[model samples]
Target chain A: MKEIRWHGRGGQGGFTAARLLGMAASLSPGYYVQAFPSFGPERRGAPVLGFTRIDTKPIHDHSKVYSCDYVVVLDESLLAVVDVFEGLKADGIMLINSARGGEAFTASGRQVYTIDATGIALAVLGQPVTSTPMFGAFVGATGLVDLPAALTAVDMTLPADSRAKNREVVEWAYNELRRKINA
Target chain B: MSNEAWEGRRAFISANDAVSYAVRLCRPEVIAAYPITPQTSVVEKLSEFIAGGGMDCQFINVESEHSAMAAVMGAAMMGCRTFTASSSQGLMYMCEMLHYVSGSRFPVVMMNANRTLAAPWNIYGDHRDSLAMRDAGWLQVYVENAQEALDTVLQAYRVAEDAAVRTPAMVCLDGFVLTHTYEIVNIPGQREVDAFLPPYAPGENVLDLANPRSLCISVAPEWQTEFRCQQQAAMEAAKGAIARADGDFAAAFGRRWGGMVEEYRCEDADYVLLGMGSVMGTTRLVVDKLRAEGLKAGLMKIRFFRPFPREEIAALGRRVKGIGVIDRDVSFGNAGALYTEAKAALYSAGGASPHTVNFIAGLSGRDITKEHIETMYRKVMNAAAGGAEREIQFAGLRWEEW
Candidate 1:
């Protein structure tokens, strides 16, 4: 069971990102998918959470994701307030939305992928839904889930009026991820 | 129960290993836990299981015990089977989260190694820790031995995961007793366990984004009562599940320890002792010795502490003329901890006919013995025969030789 924990503030589309991921994974045959939010009374701008479980076998647990194989931080500011890498497996990959790219952190011990998801989100969606571009970065860093399926998930989850912009964001992020990973 | 599989496999594994093997058999999709001994070893083994590959699972190591359970809560909210473990201060620390895990109707399996809460700084066995949190809505079971520990841990998942009882379960094994003891346990292969416990498919969860249901979300009092009624119903439903799980476990493992109350030579006994955890092993010998001497003494081992198994306990009370409860742990300011629960369980039945006596001993590994058990039996029988007058009795006190 591959559990993905999405780190983002309440309104930063953490739950939305998780839903998109689940929707994307569900498109494939032999895949069991789930998405959930941390049920709390905390409001917007407060650190909020969403989680996903993707596995070939049926998923039986609906708990928060701890030692995620992949960690995707949508907001750079969260790093100071949250220990995003707390339970990550030593060999796990992390994708962060920072303009400094992967160079911000020393990658000698672990793989760290940096994508300017904020820039991509603002340019395409004209809003700060950093999760869309960050999701692209996550796909780029780890080949565990499919990019096409993820974009398809985005299409399903986004409102029809905002669908074109979200799709463009996904495409742009995927291409950038591919280029960086290949280089 | 068998040596065929473990004949040459006497490896030095921690309580965590036993927990992991049991969890692996239960086949939970999401495994979440935070570090707190003797609970850390459990999560560590799970991490190893995930790292070694083969068991397709999502292993989540969260920042704290709070998040550890929160993670499982979120997963269980999505209608997935989830699990985590904690002990003593850690269990207490997760108090608020514990209420949420069960209140939400999420069947999560958690193991709490009963340990003492701090004061003068002790890290050993005691019941006060878990006892304090008894009001929290989780089905609790206390195991007597390592084998029982392994068995009960697995059963917890089955019981908690049942649709009729979709509630979280906490299986308590005495720290340093069952938690550290090494025994030849018949660890069931995955296939048999799968046959016994089917995959969890909840009726609904937080994952259905399109259908989007609000869970553990705020609600008005009327709706809250309906939810509480459902929770209560599930807890009441667990009694049958416990018995059924015990019987099925015995049938599968070739070891029979059925019934809500495991009676030991209680058929025609005049005096009986009752309690949970490993102390019952020593208590058994005392009952046997008294029975051999024609004293009509026996034991009523209450395995499932929560749900209290009141009817079964009352039945045991009805058979016996007097009863003695040997508690290995105590709750300060209160009477012998387990003793209080036992009396409450047997109170209305026969108006406490068994004349229950409470004996507190062996807190923090003070070493309880067959002799101690003998002293308890004698005291309880004396009380039954009008040799003592105290309604509640204390056995084996050295009195500081003052």
Candidate 2:
């Protein structure tokens, strides 16, 4: 089982990102996935969290994700406001939507990958909804799901008018992050 | 029923959306509801369906939950299939009409998003809302996930509108837990649902001008007891109707929920954890983990809380050494409702009863984790070994040291 936790604000599309990730993973024949938000009464800019769990077998544990293999932060500002790495596994990976390099973050014995997802979102989507691009960086950081599958999920979730640019941004993030990791 | 082919489709959607889709397939003639948290999406999606010409139904926008129930009752009495949904405060507001709907034997199917009642003002998932009105003479079923939420609504109408069991039914899903969670679900086609659940024939309860019959008239004290007795008999008849509906649904669609209670990994287990709603999903995982560790642990998920499944509880209790009842709602001064009911069921079985413990957890939407479930199972095992300390235990209460 691979569990991932997402951190963002109320209007930042954290919930959408989690659902999209689950939908993408579930495209595989044998994968079982779940996506849910930590629901609360909140307005825009308030801290929000969402979770996704993917597995080879049917997933039964419905409780909140305490220990997760991946943590995706949609807003780098949430790093100081909340404990983004609270329950991350020892060998887990953290993907941040930031312009800063991975060396800026100190996560002992864990890999940290930083990408300028907001920039890509602004360039491609004409708005700063970083969920799609962040998902792209996720696919790039961990080759857990196919890039084509992730793009297909993006197409399914977004409007027809926005699909072309959203797909372009996702593909750009995936290739850009993969190049950075290899470098 | 139309001879349309069964063309079920799969979708990744929330439980709320699933309920909306199910209700659409059932094709209720009338839908009246006031929006409430968690439950708001069910009606919201239904409204979208109506607006988009996906559903042909009268969607009544009522002023309050009370009015919502009253409107549905009127529509249902006129021999039209009626539907509504509410949660927490909205349910409490509609409490008065609930009894009238049941007493008149109007088969109004309602989707209740089970939420905690408020004093400190919380909007999280709990069974307090629906369970509080358990004695309103309505058939109640709690679902674990989105697919069940969809399938059960289809089954609920069948059980509710059965001539032998003319009663209202509340299909419950945990407010935020199941209502907001997204998962893959197989939605059966309208043709299959229509074939399984034929149109609602208001048979004897129709309020027509041609008949001019008096309903719910003033009854003398002597006959009131008989009226109540007949209602009780109808409820008793519902047990069979529910089972048959589940069987027929399984034959039509490819899924069945074991009718009243779902026993998981309990064939050779000595200790079983029992609960209802979404929490049971977590308990099942813990049971599997304990089984892997060689502990004789299992789970019994109560589906129909109104029927109580007394016979199934007693039968399982006879084999297990101990059973833990994990309830998300408290009965205040008494034990949790499920724990008390299970104990009474075992006591009436005319034999030695299993050692039972009550673990009250997840009130006001607090998270009940795997650790809490594991602790409850361990307590049951210890009690089975005669290490029992108390009858009722609060699973995740925080206390300051004295």
Which candidate has the highest lDDT of all?
2
TM-score of each: 0.65, 0.97
TM-score of 1: 0.65
Q: After superposition, how far is residue B177 of candidate 1 from its true place, in Å?
A: 1.6
Q: Report per-prediction Cα RMSD to one decimal.
A: 19.2, 2.3
Against the true two-chain complex, what DockQ does each candidate achieve? Answer: 0.01, 0.79
Q: What lDDT would each prediction earn against the true structure?
A: 0.74, 0.89
> Which digits, one per residue and each the tens of the lDDT, describe model 1 over residues A7-46?
8998898877777777677666667665656643347899
| Candidate 1 lDDT by residue in tens digits, B1-402 | 132442223222334467777887787889888877566667777787778774578998788888888988988887777888898888877899999988877888888887778875576676767777777888888777655677777788878877789888888877765565433344667777788788887887456878977888778886988988888788789999888887888887666565466888888888888887777866776676787888898888877766678787777776777888877666666777678877777876776576768887666555576767787787788888877656555555677210
Tens digits of lDDT, candidate 2, B343-382? 9888876696788999998987888999889988888888
Best by DockQ: 2
Cα deviation at B90, candidate 2, in Å, is 0.4
